[model samples]
Target: MLVYLRLLKESLSFAINALRNNKLRTLLSLLGVTIGIFSIIAVLAAVDSLDRKISKDLSSLDKNTIYLMKYCFGPSEIPQWKREQFPNVKYDEYISLKNSLTNTDQVAYQFFVNKETIKYDSKTVSDVNIVPASNEIVEIEGLNVDNGRFYTESESNSGTAVIVLGYDIAEGLFGGSEPVGKSIRLYGQRFTVIGVIAKQGAGFFGDSNDTSVYIPTNFLRRMYGDNDAMTPVIVLKPVKGVDMDAYKAQVAQKLRAIRGMKAGEMDNFFINVLSGFTDFIDGILGQMNVVGWVISGFSLLVGGFGIANIMFVSVKERTNLIGIQKSLGAKNRFILFQFLFEAVILSVIGGIIGLLLVWGISLALTQLLDFEFVLSLGNILLGTGISAIIGLISGILPAISAANLDPVEAIRTGM
Candidate 1:
């Protein structure tokens, strides 16, 4: 063991000397490994960050949650014209589903509205997301009130002029002062701020509640009647441990009955499950992972070749030293181990620099954008392990040739 340690120390010293003496050649040889590590690790970190964000954004909502609406969340067999002809889901339908559907939890009516400006006295915010949803949305969407309270059933039914401000919205409109009970102007009407939502940094689709305000859907309907610009949706959260297929069938049947659709006519609305959307995103991410592997595999292959070539050159240059060492009673295994350790050490140095580059970029990106980028310890270990493997594989043949060289022949060839 002590002998192996001495060999390792000597190998490390040789690697450092090689790097210092042949700066350009060493860096050029390391470039492929560096780029390969950077490529693989960067892709992994990005995908991981995106996956984490998705989990965070959807954590409150059940994966089994369904949206009953005219619009499809993904591609549909139904043509665009037919979809456009399908009437927007009515509030009555939402009510019917809430009452009639089995294996259900909370049902909510939501309005998809255009960007609107909101005002609190002189302070104003534009292009803000206006979430006009039924009071039950609080339960269905798992919304938490940071201050005051979410709208009550009575307030929703009566279309009371109350609003819940998102965290950043409150900060923008009221600064340090409390926003609850304060009046805000939107849609040419005054709404008393009744609650504030917790700071939700970003939503699943780049939408954030931070710049949003929630009001009763009834209030919006009462104010504007029916406008083409506003589309209504029924959001449903099914009970856990239920037969999902049977539950969805029952929901479709109830809605078909409500819409008076003839048998075999096909229901006009789309039943989009949240799980399917997440699965679709997962598939895309999987493809990205595969692509990253393919692209980086080539780079790593090139890097391996580079290391092999460098090792061959190193063996050639050290033939005289090897001959001397063998003449002085050094074993073939020691010579082989020395070359192998030097190759691995050199490759690992390149990987470390690549990892440092990734870490720096991740830090910069997280600071510059709302999204957070992460480089986990597991990935760091993976990079280092991969580098070591590349070096070992690349150096094996050259090290064997060095080990097998006849001391007399090697010394004469060097001379």
Candidate 2:
């Protein structure tokens, strides 16, 4: 054990001395390693940050809730006429479906109409997202009111011209003044503000929840003067104490009945739970990960070759020294180990610098570019491991050449 430790210490000392002796060559070799490791770490940090943002955004939707829509989230290949076939599902249909479902505690239906500029006096806000939703949206969607209150079921049934403002919208229109009970004009019609939603921040796609406005579905329909049923996106939550799986089955059965679909026939409406959406997103990220590694692996391979060439040059320059060491009774294995140790040291230092660079870039992105930064243990390990492997392999040929040198001939030629 002591002999092994001594050998390791000697190898490190020798490697250090060699690095110090060849200042320019060492810098250039380390630069290659730095570039390779920088690529890996930068890619990994970006992927980690992207994954985190995506997971956070997806998780924003309720786990037990399902979306009832006319189209699938995975693809845009749905026939255009299919949406026309439904036109709009009636509000009465929602009550009928809710009554039929014994396992569901709450169900909310929502849809959006074409956006119109909201005007308050001379101030105008055009970037507002307007959603028409049922009263159950307050419960099923886990909404919190920042001021006033959400519109009542009675109000929705009567098609009351009431609006609920999101935090950003409220601030933009009211300028920190109380907006509840005030009037705002949308689509040439005046609507009274009843509530302001708490801030929900931004999703991964940069969609801001606070920039939205909500109102009764009936009010939205009335604004269009269309009794035609709009395709409602229904969100349902299971009753407390009911087993989720059983509730899902019961809800499915009830929805099929309401849609008047016979058994074995596909239902017209789509139901999307957490699993399908998460799986779809994960599959995309998985493909990205594979592609990123394949590209970065090529960069690492090229960098390894650069290190090998530099080491070869170094070995040739130190031929006389190697011969002297051999003449002083150094073993072939000792000479090989010294060169290998130097290569590993160089690679590791470059890797550390690369990691630091990545961290700096991540900080800059978060502070200046509004991107989230994430660092993971897995990525760190991957970068370090790849760098070490590059060093070991790159050192092989040079190490072997140094080990196999003819000491007498080397001394005679001063090589």
Candidate 3:
């Protein structure tokens, strides 16, 4: 073991000397590897960060939750015109489903309404998201209340003039003062602030919980009377361990009977399952990863050739030293290991530089952009493993060639 360690130390010394002696050749060789590592790792890190952000944004809601609406989230057989012609999900259907739907944890009705301006005294905040939803949305969405409480079912059923403020909206209107129990004007009417939601950072989309205000769905219904612009949707959160296929089928059958659709006729509404949407997104991200690998693989291929070329040149330059070592009882394996060590050292150096670049860029992007960029330990290990593999593959042929050289012939050629 001690003898092997001494051999390894010598091989390392030779590897460093080769790199130091050939500055221009070493830089050119390292460039290809560095670029390859950078391209691959950067793409992977970016995609991973995006995926994490998506997961974080959606963490509160159940993936099995279903949205009953006129439109579908994924590709559908139904045409655009047919989807458009389909009637909007009604408040009555939401009520019916809530009471009658089996294997359901909770159900909610929400309106996709236009942005509204909120006013408290002289302070005015515009382009605020107006989420008029049923009280059950609190549980369905797993909303966290920092102050006061969410509106009760009675207030929602009665269409009371009560509102829940988002973190930013509350901060903007009241500043240091308490926002709960205060009256705010929205849609030219005063609403009592019932609760304030906990602070949530930026969402995957521009619209965040921090910039939204929740009101009772019935309040908007009494005023607008099922306006198409409001686009009512029924959200269903199924109980855990329920058979999703049967549950969705049961829902379709019930809705079909309610709408009085004839036999063999297709259901007008779409059942947009959250799990299906996430699966579709996962497919897209997987394709992106494949593309990144293919593109970066070309750079790595070039880098491998560069490393092989440098290794072969190093072997030729050290022919005299190799012959002397062999004459002094050095083994063929030592000659092979020497070149392999050099190749690996160069590749690893390039990879380390690439990793450093990625780390610096990740920090800058996280600070500058709204989205956070993470370089995970798994990815770092993956990058390092990839680098070392590239080294072994590139060094093998040259290492073998060095090992097989005739000591006397090599010494004469070098002289």
| Per-candidate clash tally | 0, 3, 0
Backbone collision tally, model 3: 0
lDDT, candidates in the order shown? 0.90, 0.77, 0.90
Specify the highest-lDDT model's number: 1
How much does candidate 2 score in TM-score? 0.85
For residues 13-67, what per-residue lDDT tens digits would candidate 3 score against the true structure?
8777877888889889978888889888998999999899889988999999999
Alpha-carbon RMSD, each predicted model: 1.2, 3.5, 1.4
Clashing pairs in 3: none
> In lDDT terms, how accurate is model 1?
0.90
lDDT of 2 by residue, 1-415 (tens): 7855777687677667767887777767777677777877787688778878877655545566777666666664557677446434555567777777776768877875556679999899996788888888888766779899999999877779999998888888999788999999986889999999888766676555588888888776666654344456777777656677787677667767776779897556666776677777778877777777777777677778877887798788778888998999989998888888777766777777778788888888898867778767877887788788888999999999999999997676673
The residue pairs that clash in candidate 1, if any, are: none
Looking at candidate 1, the ten consecutive residues that score lowest on lDDT are 202-211
Clashing pairs in 2: 88-229, 88-230, 320-415
323 Cα displacement, candidate 1 (Å): 1.1
How are the candidates ranked when ordered by lDDT, highest leading? 1, 3, 2
Candidate 2 residues lying further than 4 Å off, grouped into runs, are 1-32, 76-88, 225-231, 239-249, 413-415
Off by over 4 Å in 3: none
